[model samples]
Target chain A: MTLDALIQRLRDFADARDWNPDHTPKNLVMALAGETGELTALFQWLTPDQSRQAMGDPHLRERVLDEIADVLLYLTRLADVLGVDLLAAANAKIDRNELRFPARQA
Target chain B: MTLDALIQRLRDFADARDWNPDHTPKNLVMALAGETGELTALFQWLTPDQSRQAMGDPHLRERVLDEIADVLLYLTRLADVLGVDLLAAANAKIDRNELRFPARQA
Candidate 1:
């Protein structure tokens, strides 16, 4: 599904609960931090190699993906509420990064 | 740009810097958490109304968007490095949420 479609669904889900009033940027960002914290916990103790292989097991993969799904959902919701065009902002940031971190010559 | 396109560009940017060894899931998730923390700080003290109006000021808007851009970039990188299809996972989660929170009859 497209980002727009997913955003619409998320909005609908919240609206059904009459949650627009509670989905303020402050609230959303706090919720987002909590989700990110949980996500970090999943990979926190793993060594680099174990981290790379951390998702090999179905159970761990599901847990990791679940957290990721939460992270992205809140992130996109925050962007929408802030009137930020996530794709455009990301593209612009990358454009700046390309200049900031130019390729080193071989 | 589509998420896939942005993801590829992110990968290219990291690869140019020979960042693969360092971009382990653990590192990426930690990085993501840092970005999310920065994003949270932007609105941490704002009240709900102030937070809603946070981006109205052009200067504040730019700073907020920059953090969000960073947050999304690290998040997508973590997903890519872990082989998670962000869109699919998000959609699946929404599907589950829909079941969990049905619309109330008015």
Candidate 2:
């Protein structure tokens, strides 16, 4: 499924579970951090190859994916609640960066 | 000032600039990346001390602080618009991380 579709599904899932209320910017940030930790757990000190091969277990893959999705979903919801056009803000920042870091140096 | 106060002031600044509408998740993400680049520019290949010393110039310090604030403001706006409680979310994420990366391992 498309990313947008997946996000929608995730949103719906949250809404259905009445979990949306707990998704304040503060809460989402915490949740995102938690999920990031989960993602990190998959590769604390493993070799690069071992980390890459983490998807070997279907169940484990699903679990990891779920945590990652949770992070993204909460972030998306955070953006929505704050009335942010993340894409536009991001592009503007890029322009600033180009000025700050010239291509020659980069 | 407190972080909350600073954030509130930032929101006011963005609102005054008519920039909030453009802060969609995508735009904010892009803006964040750009600001990150700016932050990175001050330290490319430089020693940590040199990077820290770059703040010697008051104007430069202001510029750097402004860029960093911009990144955070956009992110906060993104979260606000999306209804995410960033603090709560962050805390949740930390908890998840604790589970994923226990203290001994971390």
* DockQ for each model: 0.83, 0.03
Among the numbered candidates, top DockQ falls to 1
lDDT of 2 at B6: 40
Best by TM-score: 1
Candidate 1 lDDT, tens digit per residue, B1-106?
Answer: 7899989999988888898899999999999999998988888778899999999889889999899999999998999999999999999988888778777845
* Candidate 1 segments whose C-alpha is farther than 4 A from its true place: none
lDDT of each: 0.90, 0.50
Q: What is the interface RMSD of each candidate, in Å?
A: 1.0, 15.4
lDDT of 1 at B89: 95
Model 1 chain B worst lDDT window (10 residues): B97-106
Clashes of 1: 0
lDDT of 2 at B26: 43
